[model samples]
Target: MRKNEDNKNIAVIYWSNSENTEIMAEKISNGIDETGQKADLYNVSQFPIERIEDYDKVALGCPSMDGEALEKNTFEPFFEEIESKLKGKKVALFGSYGWGNGEWMRDWEDRIGHTGARLFDEGLMIKEFPDDAGRHACVEFGKAFASF
Candidate 1:
């Protein structure tokens, strides 16, 4: 069955330093498009945190920064501001990392969950740049999130 018009709006927001995370965001958007839906992609700096409330679904992508943490400047503040509003929202997370295990993603998931956002599924973490397999996973991730 096709999604209703109201269910089609999705926001894909991310912060990328090496551009790896942005690539992943685009792949996820491609997946969303494959599902016959479109998502507005935004760099965290450009997207208004309050506008997160406008979309029915949100997929946030950000690479791990110093000590496996969210990018300190843009993505972090954006996430912190919109977190409380995530209550009852449908959301997903994905990103790339240069080192360390996916501890950043784990903490992020737990933090978002505590705010009451309904997670679309497990978070997706790709090391360094996303290769073909990782991109494919991102597409599938987007498709799954769209399904939700």
Candidate 2:
């Protein structure tokens, strides 16, 4: 089953300030690897918007920031830049939250809808840093996404 999986077409991009969201991103990548698809992991700043077409599927992660919004300085701008490129692509979203409900993720899901991108699943949100169970969940989410 692991004989011919390619690694070039899937990417996991995330932005984290407190490192909680980054941890989730790593686990999700682990899951994707488990499915025999080696996904590229990148911080938002490290990923160029022009490369959106290079990946058929993408996992985006950003923690809740400043009143339940995306981290403005980097991730928000990156997302805005790539929103148009997501049309017909498979996209998944995940992140960590320190407070409030998951309003940010819902809004994000809606935005992806506007672009005509197919969502791999509902947004995955974890409060604060993820414990062992949460980590396992992230990995499973990644596995499913890769399989999708």
Candidate 3:
């Protein structure tokens, strides 16, 4: 675990079609705040990929589309642009889904891992709208990631 005085900067960027992922992103930021770490939250549309290298930790959120992976329009390009910048960073993933198994999260984890970023924990996922348990889990994920 990193020392509390490390002062690492963390960022959470998310794209949400139905607002669920956005709420999760806020919860993640809250968890990071609880640990007394600095966190920045941004919508994927406004996320500055060029600045990713300035952060020590990053958490990305995207809803599943067509039972496949991240929403294509914003997330795909954003991810691609930042992939090469992620080596050796601490990262986490989260998303909301309406249907299908959680294969999207697994695939995303694999892809991010390939970039050499250490995943903080298993990716956080929710079926449709997340319930209380799921939100709490996301918060825990944030706390754990901050400490990593």
RMSD of each: 2.6, 2.6, 2.8
Candidate 1 colliding pairs = none
Candidate 1 on 1-148: residue-level lDDT in tens? Answer: 2333566569899999998999999999889888888888888888976687787788999998999999997888888899888887889999999999999999999998899988977789999999999999999998888889
Worst 10 residues of 1 by lDDT: 1-10
* C-alpha lDDT values of all predictions: 0.88, 0.90, 0.85
Off by over 4 Å in 1: 1-8
Which model scores highest in lDDT?
Answer: 2
Clashes of each: 0, 0, 0
Residue pairs in collision within model 2: none
**For model 3, how big is the CA root-mean-square deviation?**
2.8
lDDT of 2 by residue, 1-148 (tens): 1221754488899999988999999999999988877888998888978888888889999999999999898889889999999998899999999889999999999999999999988999999999999999999999999988
